[model samples]
Target: MLSVKKLEAFYGDFQALFGIDFEIGESETVSIIGSNGAGKSTFLKTVCGQLKAAPSAIIFAGEPIGGKPANEIVAKGIAMVPEGRRLFRSLTVEENLLMGGFAKRSGPWNLKRVYQLFPALEEKRNNLSTALSGGQQQMVAIGRALMANPKILICDEVSLGLAPIVVKGIYDALPKITSDGLAVIIVEQDIDTAMRVSDRVYCFMHGRVSLKGRSADLTKNQISDAYFGI
Candidate 1:
């Protein structure tokens, strides 16, 4: 239930996204795959309101929210699990998760529910956030975002530094997280993970969509062509 149109993002004089057009339907999982500097993260940042854009660029649930502040966006049912698992090291795991609920939106997601989604977090609820492993930390990040009970969840580089098995564990939990008609936009460098978990895939190249289609229908050759801009 989100639409991005003619989305052009810039970093001072250097532009990153080139009129990127994308959409995320209700309860849909959309993956964005691209190499470094392809603007995949840029797109997520723009959608999450970290990178400002024109008011008409991003529409969520039919209203334009492009230039809104990040807090406002989160309040409007969009939450982001940014790259690097930027958790509050000083806070306990539970405290970090509680921060997400500051939005105070009413929904199915809550501390109890998030704990059910990642049972491991329950045991570590009182532990220092920095003490958790990378995967556990990632879980905390995801759980933190879920605490907002968002309609759309944006995950940027969720698998960046975790082990393969750990990444798989994280991806495996996505179905349950999105089961309640939540739209998800995942920015992943791992093509296989992206293709596996997403209903549709969008390959970015040089700050634009080189290919977009059903994940199951997109052959390896087509993905390679789009991925490398061949």
Candidate 2:
């Protein structure tokens, strides 16, 4: 479980998030949706320790972990699949996955399990990450994060550049990924997909939480109004 209270972030005084509060429970899937510059990514960065925050701002598994180093955060059981898929061009697919395990945490995810999750990765395990198709590269990114065996997995824009079918395949795997009680936070631009995949949804606008509710309870007009400040 994780809790964020009055979270704020900045880049040299240019603030990006404003008093945002959020929480996730075990095995829960939460989605964050907003337009560009809505601070979705900024909130994630602060959570994963890429950006600094007040010590009391972020409480994970009951302890305050704000402003810790990224590596330390990963060791504390939070892993992120960044927006760009950010795979290592020089490393082979398997090697890139192995990099994620540098934290050396113990859990259900490993090479064999990841391969089972995405059969394509096993077939091209030795190929350079850059050589894979966009979808496959995204698989490698997800697989890489899973390799960390994190309690909380954060995925940013997993469907960004992929084909619809490819995106579907990835989204379809969510049930399996979270079956082990892994909490997931997804930052998505596709509102429909976000609503479909998450139990709860948070809409961000201009660095603040504009609306939040159970995904099924939110009407299209409500989401539209919150999303666009209409």
Residue-wise C-alpha lDDT for candidate 1, range 108-185, written one tens digit per residue = 999999999999999999999999999999999999999999999999999998999999999999889888999899
**Backbone clashes counted, model 1:** 0
Best by lDDT: 2
Residue-level lDDT of model 2, residues 58-103, one tens digit each, is: 9999999999999999999999999999998999999999998999
**Residue pairs with clashing backbones, model 2:** none
Q: Give me the runs in candidate 1 sitting further than 4 Å from their true place.
A: none
Candidate 2 TM-score over all chains jointly: 0.99
**Cα deviation of 216, candidate 1, in Å:** 0.5
TM-score of each: 0.98, 0.99
Global CA lDDT computed for model 1: 0.94
